[model samples]
Target: MILNFFDQFCIPNLLGVPLIILALFFPLMTWFTTNRLIQNRYSTVQSSFLIYITKQMMLPINITGHKWANTLITLMLMLMLLNTLGLLPYTFTPTTQLSMNMALAMPAWLMTVLTGLRNQPTASLGHLLPEGTPILLIPMLILIETASLLIRPIALGVRLTANLTAGHLLIQLTSTAVLALMNTMTATAMMTLVVLILLSCLEMAVALIQAYVFVLLLTLYLQENI
Candidate 1:
């Protein structure tokens, strides 16, 4: 039963080759292109959203970190599209995979750390120790801080994976219950259907929010370094 519940998360295959690669790139197809001089509604909305999100994300970053603006925005959009599209029937969500999430998290976190180390070594290293520390507790504090620093990427990945996974499981369970009750308990099934709809909407919001959070954390890490 447990295996059945988790089976949906497994990487889909075609002729023994993983379809996750296709899943990863599928979102790109949904992106709006602005090739025409007179933009259509889709292109206009896409450009406006990009501009707004870019402004918001750049507001907190310093000039030195502005170079990361494009990378961060592109990542956020990719994640948002992947997560949103995953909610569709017969689609896979790469973000729900821990390995994929960690792959995204680790590089972003490492880049921030490296930026800090390269640009401001003393300040970055200073983060490992708080000011006015007791002499005896200094060593212990340094160890704790070091542990926390190293755990950032893991935390980022786990948070995204857990949230999306839990939401997907809930939606699945609710949907299954609705289907099971439709014949025997019409009224109850209707109620369950309504709940399922609500859950779907909430999940969509979570999908976007989690992607934003992932990038926001990366931005904060960069801010600390820069």
Candidate 2:
């Protein structure tokens, strides 16, 4: 059973789901606690603003915790670490698979919905419409906004999966080339090994870069969409 699952997931398909779930609320615990402690010790403008926002948000329900934001940051970090780890020489790179990337991106898309729902019920749909849209254009604006919002997550998923998949396939092809060029089978073996190692290192760098890009884009989207 274990071997079967490993064989199935060794190429990066569905593994990101468990990781995303585990990381779902990690940011809140890591971020809010630290922020609270820092504010108690040093009350700065930033700290005050954070506290004020917390208070305003919690006035009705008293949710003094910055749990939502924390959870998101934590989720981002978890994805980054998981993806980077997968870039190891002998390991499977999960993010290289489309199914895995879609699972991860889905939560981000859901968060945008929840953010609007929780914070701005009346004005939520207006996010797509922008401010000061003319009366004549309001209906058209809403339609365009609806289409754009629906498409954001699909683009996010495809971008990540395609990049990872292409990178891995490229490295594999290059390693194959190193093997094909050899006059002696023995020398080809050695060159193939070297190319594999070099590609492994390259993959590691790409892993880090991809993770950073994913999270950075995620944060930017949240900043606006939320």
How many steric overlaps are in each model, in order? 0, 4
115-201, model 2: which lDDT tens digit per residue? 767876667766877788899999898898888888878888888777666667766666666666665676777878787788778
User: Looking at model 1, how many pairs of residues clash?
Assistant: 0
Which candidate number would show the highest TM-score if scored against the true structure?
Answer: 1
Q: What overall lDDT, based on C-alpha atoms, would model 2 receive against the true structure?
A: 0.64
- Model 2, which residues run further than 4 Å from truth? 1-69, 184-200
Error of 2 at 110 (Å): 0.8
Candidate 2: residue pairs that collide = 27-70, 27-74, 28-70, 28-71
Best by lDDT: 1
* TM-score of every prediction relative to native: 0.91, 0.60
Model 1 bad stretches (over 4 Å) = 1-3, 13-36
RMSD of 2: 9.8
